[model samples]
Target chain A: MLIDVTDAGDPRLVDYVGLRDAQLRRPEVSRFIAEGVKIIERAFAAGCTPRSLLLQPRWLPGLRELIDAWPDVPVYLASEALIEHVSGFHVHRGALGSFDRPQETGWDELLGGRRLIVCEDTVDHANLGAIIRVAAGLGWDGVLVSPGSADPLYRRAVKASMGSSLALPWRRMASDSDLQRLRDAGFTLVASTLAPGAVDLAGLEPPAKAALLLGTEGQGLSDAWSAAADRHVTIPMAAGVDSLNVATAAAILAYALRP
Target chain B: MLIDVTDAGDPRLVDYVGLRDAQLRRPEVSRFIAEGVKIIERAFAAGCTPRSLLLQPRWLPGLRELIDAWPDVPVYLASEALIEHVSGFHVHRGALGSFDRPQETGWDELLGGRRLIVCEDTVDHANLGAIIRVAAGLGWDGVLVSPGSADPLYRRAVKASMGSSLALPWRRMASDSDLQRLRDAGFTLVASTLAPGAVDLAGLEPPAKAALLLGTEGQGLSDAWSAAADRHVTIPMAAGVDSLNVATAAAILAYALRP
Candidate 1:
């Protein structure tokens, strides 16, 4: 169903309001707003069903087939200015899709993979997204993010990943027991840390099935995860420099340890 | 020289106005603004002479010694609200410093080292900064940026690098001849690209002196640079994934090829 929305305050456009406000954009509500034409297309490509779409008419021809596929879905047409007004920022890419958030990847499927990235409390959405992109790009099979980690489906995260978050396999760990579950599935947990006495990353030979564990931005891997790791690795740094950005570090590690 | 300015429009406060506006913030005007307490301290530690400082009174005692060292420099004290009003953003970090932009690193000095990162038109300040941070952290000696690259001294870039931009040695290339100069100076130019037939990054044994060249966000590298490289290298990726973020790619290359 195609609906023309002239009023920015339309009640049906609530899903698109204040898109830039982090607190208002909730991915946990079983929905996420996919911004930009490319990202919206990626969401659909990833098999995410769109609840609705708000877009300028200029984008209609390009997205016509996708819209036709979901004839029952409401496609709200509006001018660029009105959509910008409704979203609290310029929707410069000219389209937005409200997607039903995909279900979490099952633990058995995630852990059954040969390569995995396990993020512990990685709170920055961009960082989490970048991690996902690199992990997927380097052929890592899946990602396991701790409960406190930022939602990969968040707009910024999705945008930063260049929509890889939609295509990659990932799940949020319910608790610390998830770490044990990974170990029980034959993963050799390798913690990326800055702690002294850890073997240099370049020297280590990863196992056939391995999970690279990364921690939050400031404080590194938790003491429990660090101690529990089958091995600890550090990327040697020039004196006085603290560390690389968490995602940058993940990319380097993923590339170095790729199976 | 201690000063208290109540008005945000004070002509003396021009350097601090519109701090968040990229077009308005020009480090090329012989000065750069350093935000937050730690970055300000790092600026001073890196020997950047302070022209002036706009900061909350609460931060004065913490920076007393450094401020005292440059008694001739104006220290403009303002409430956080006033500073935020002038800068057009929350001055939550409680301080900002206008410092003399340091002199460019000499070509001979930048190329003298064995390991280097050369960025060609790397326009994203944060990516450029992260590349610098990783290069420095991984013990790479210096960075060489093409004329079109973003300024490493940009506030966001400096902040993104965790202030490593201050301490790392970097210089802008004067021309394409500058790259030729590196080759003449016994450096192997390794271009990071997604082009076919490129040697996998892991397969190459980096020469004693190596320069890893990275390009802009969308495009991998320029034709001239790619053709001129002694070796073309790639971090192999899964099919269907376009590319890794340039900074992330740089981190992986820097770590893998660290001398």
Candidate 2:
């Protein structure tokens, strides 16, 4: 449905308003806003049902087939100025989409993989999404984020991942206790750390089923998590540098240890 | 050295004004501003001479030693709001320093390294910096950027590198012909590409001296450069994914091909 809107306060456009409000962007929230034409297309390709779309006419030709396939889905046509005025920020890509958030992969499926990435507290959304992109690209089966991690479905993350977060199998753990389930599945838990005794990464041959544990941005894996791992591996770096960015480390680790 | 200023338009503060002007931030510009105390400290550690310092009082105590050492350098003290207002953007890390642009490495020193990262048209400052950080962290000896690449010493690049860009050896290429110098130096020019029939990265052994060529963000390597390479190697990814982010690819390649 093509709905033309001139007013910023149109009741029908409520889903796109006040998007910067933290309450609306929470991971538990039922909807996520995909910000660009490519990401919106990815959302549809991944089977997400759109609640509505706000776009300038310039983007129509590229997205015509998608809008045609879903006649019931609201497609709000607005002038770029009105869209910016209403959204309170310029939509850089000039296309904004609101979609029903998809369900996360279940533990049984996420844990059945031969390779996995477990983020303990990867709070930065871009970092979390980048990790997912590399994990999926290199053939890792899934990703597990601790409760405190950022939402993989968040718009910036979705953009940063180039929409890989939408395609990959990922889930948020209920608590630290969920980690034990991986060990029960006959997986060797390897922690990426900079501790003194950890074996050089080049020396550690990955086990049959392996889960690599990554930590927060500034700190390496927490002591408790490091102590809990079946093996500890460290990337030897040049002197004077403290550590690699969490996402960069994930890319290296995922590629080096890929099955 | 501790001159307090209340005016946002103060004449001595001209260096920090209109910083958003691309003309001022150009790579050819004789100076680059370092935002935040940490990057400022990195500039100092890297032996770059300071032109001036702008800071709020809270950062004073921590920087007293360095301030005292450089008594001739003007330290403009201001309130946080004044600093933000004058700079036209908030300095998130609360301190900014203007420094003389450091010199780039010459061909002899840069090409003599056993492992190097060669960036071609990497225009994103953050990506360029992350590539340098990973190269430094993974023990690559130096970096050589094509003329069109982002400035390694740019503030965001410096901060993104966690100051590694300051310490790493990197220089600009006069033209693609600088690549010829690498070949003459016994450096194997390894091009990273997704082209058909390229050898898998895992199957190839690192030559005695290796140089990895990285391309622009979206289009991947240009045909000219890919054909210029001594060896074509690729990281085989899962189907449906087009390619890895240039920086992420650099990380995996640097780590795997590290000396």
Candidate 3:
């Protein structure tokens, strides 16, 4: 199963190149490329099967058991130099794998009897991944991403999440219909904003079923989202400072309201 | 006085060269380099004076007003090619500044009505900076770094903070003695941990005068520090996930407990 490959143009590796946004429209096309041993192992531990793997010849010994564990998957081998050439960057981790992205869950299914984070237009992949990592660590049940958000399956996101993005229950809001569906599911929308009229984050009593809504970097939550929310809360900051990173803000808000 | 220098090792730019730990520790090191225009401007706005400004000649027209405002600071000129070489990297931002690091603040004075974030062993500059940025935005009073923490004045920390590190009140705690002094004061020490019998993060109400303590990346709270704390709280996480980034965790905890 460990076949050696030298050509970057190999038809099998087509799914690996610039694979970030290819499946934005069709979430089914989402393929996760987990690099490094720890991430790959975690992905498998999370019940994800590697569709294929690319490894440096030197790592063959270390990866033998893992490869043996996945006998059905095509384990491609190449020289370290060839891997560096094909990857177009120095991959010190010595290995990479392609895995099918996990399936999505409905808002009610994901949010039932648990805390949830709603990230609105968080377009940065690293921030998205970091938020997921925090959510996983802070006991949040799941994450709901707006359509304008970045693909969470990006290599940077997966690596940044430390592989938790794969394991965490998350789904993209397919459309405004999806957002409306979430609103109708009895989840109290807590939109985070810094406007004068907003209540202090700590001042609010915890809701029974809640979604902590975060926003983009510069522009905060959209008026429509704020209008739809049951409450608007602000993390009181110094007079001159702007806002915290959306992920950091979400982590704090989610933790504050954790069920 | 604009001087154009072609050499990377020009003595006039000594403060801006190969920025390592030793260089940052020098007592005579008055000026820290700011990479982007926003950070440089923020430093100036916070009443920190710039010793000199460096920029690609192409930026001359756009930054005329800002340059004119800083009448006392010497501006150095370089071509796009020369600027990149001198900085040892690409200068896409087209501007940089050398500003004086401010004097330290007394712990008591910094603690006055300020929601202080006390970082124990967070030695990562990027995380330190991000935490500062969040602290500033969330209306925290100041930040205190323990013995093993990274220098906030480091170049990367300054960049990551988006310049808010310069604006926020900050100081370093050289040892356990300094932490003891903080306890001698009436500051509540809320150390974050994953240990059994710890209070849940959400349940622990914010104290009027409090300092939120964060630990290192892999290791949770140290036994000595955890014992010293007035209260120990854990951010409830899912069973399988490892942990959150130290800074993200800090941000969340800080915001949740902010006054």
Task: Indicate which candidate wins on TM-score.
Answer: 2
Residues A1-259 of candidate 1 have per-residue lDDT tens digits of 8999999899999889888888533546778878889889889988998999999988999999999999999999999999999999888667999988888888778877999999998888889989999998999998988888888888889888988888899998888778888789899999999998899887999888999999998899999889889989988878888788999999988987897
DockQ of 3: 0.67
Write candidate 3's Cα lDDT for B24-60 as tens digits.
6443467687876777777778888788888877667
Off by over 4 Å in 3: A3-30, A55-65, A76-82, A90-92, A106-115, B1-30, B56-66, B77-82, B90-92, B106-115, B205-209, B227-230
- Sorted by lDDT, highest first, which candidate order results? 2, 1, 3
Task: State the lDDT of candidate 2 residue by residue for B120-212, as single tens digits.
Answer: 999988899899999999889899889888888877788788888878999989998888999999999999999888899999899999999
At residue A36, candidate 3 shows an lDDT of 85
Q: Where does the lowest 10-residue lDDT sum fall in candidate 1 chain B?
A: B23-32
- What TM-score does model 3 achieve against the real structure? 0.85
Q: Each candidate's DockQ score against the native complex?
A: 0.89, 0.86, 0.67
| lDDT tens digits by residue: candidate 2, A95-117 | 99999999999988987899999
Which structure among the candidates has the greatest DockQ? 1
Tell me each candidate's TM-score: 0.95, 0.97, 0.85
Judge candidate 3 at residue A148 and give its lDDT: 86
| Candidate 3 local lDDT, residue B61 | 78
Better of 2 and 3 by TM-score: 2
